[model samples]
Target: MFIAFAGLPSSGKSSTARALGRIMEAETLLEPEESDWPLLVQERAVMGAFTALTWFRTVRVPKLFRAEDKRTQGGSVIVDSYYDVLIGDYLGKPAFNWLMPTNDPYFDAASAMVREDWNRLPKADVLVFLYLDEDTWMDFMKKRDRDFDRSAQLESHFEMQELMLQASRRAATEHHTKLLVIEQRSGSPEDTALRVRDRLEEFA
Candidate 1:
């Protein structure tokens, strides 16, 4: 079985995925390394590099997926943030907007590359979506040690989050996968994890 956790930044995705892995005694895959192509592309903010990005995706994301597949053959596997980063951050928002300002042929090509990759991946058996209201999400962001340049970008960020959520729902439905939406408002990480584990147990 493959379980995936998707959500916006600081939405408790990593913690919940870890907890679920423990509860299910499943191997867990966290977000890919920061040095990978996705982060590199975003950091560089280069335009007209869609083909390069596609090559990177072809070379890298599959390796991670294959590892997950190998683990699943033996036992259950849980993944944190998997394609969410690709769809939400890399393609949906910052990378495209911040980097590819021209919105030229390369940008269009890159978007298609991202879409192709999203379709290529095997759908999770269970997809858990973690979301918080705007105020709560902003609060959570502020509490983090990261810089707060998001004041201007919040609206777009929220839009991207919603888009990702919709895509997740569509993917789940199309693939006949089980979908679990968790509205995380007031609760400790442990409490949220408990709820996720309990919900998943019903399907188990």
Candidate 2:
């Protein structure tokens, strides 16, 4: 099985993926590091968003294909994030209007890029959304202590949290993949992983 987790920045995706990987003894793949990504976006704004999005998409395609290969070999693989959230939710979406305006030339370029590459990427067998309420999401963001996240307006994050859920549903439906929304606020990621494991069994 190839499982992919999608959610907001501090939504415990890496944690939960690690836990689930341990439980299933699967190979867990973390998203590429974006150490200076915030700085890049801050420096160039719109163009920066375009660059970062393009970079993410470029790096993510091979990872998805690798996950598919492992699955074909009968090994389970888990990924910390899915590309659909980036492609569908962030492209010309209100949630990221602060970063990429809908009318910007870069926005059009980014959209065109996604359209060109969308069909090449492999879809996950299960798409999990780590759902958190506004207060919990904000709390996690603060606890993570990233300066960029700390200073950003809370409304943008809130909108993103909501839009991610909506986008996850749409992507799952479009791909005919299993969609699982697991609430992350009420329990530990390990607990959530167990729930996901059980749900995957049900799907099987």
Candidate with best TM-score: 2
| Model 1, span 24-126: residue lDDT tens | 6778777533344454444343423554455455564654576457556776877776562246234635423533444556776666666766666666778
lDDT: worst 10-residue window of model 1: 145-154
- Model 2 lDDT per residue over 160-183, tens place: 777777777877777777889888
Instruction: Give me the overall lDDT of model 1.
Output: 0.65
User: What are the RMSDs of all candidates, in order?
Assistant: 4.3, 2.5
**TM-scores of all models?**
0.75, 0.86
Clashing pairs in 1: none
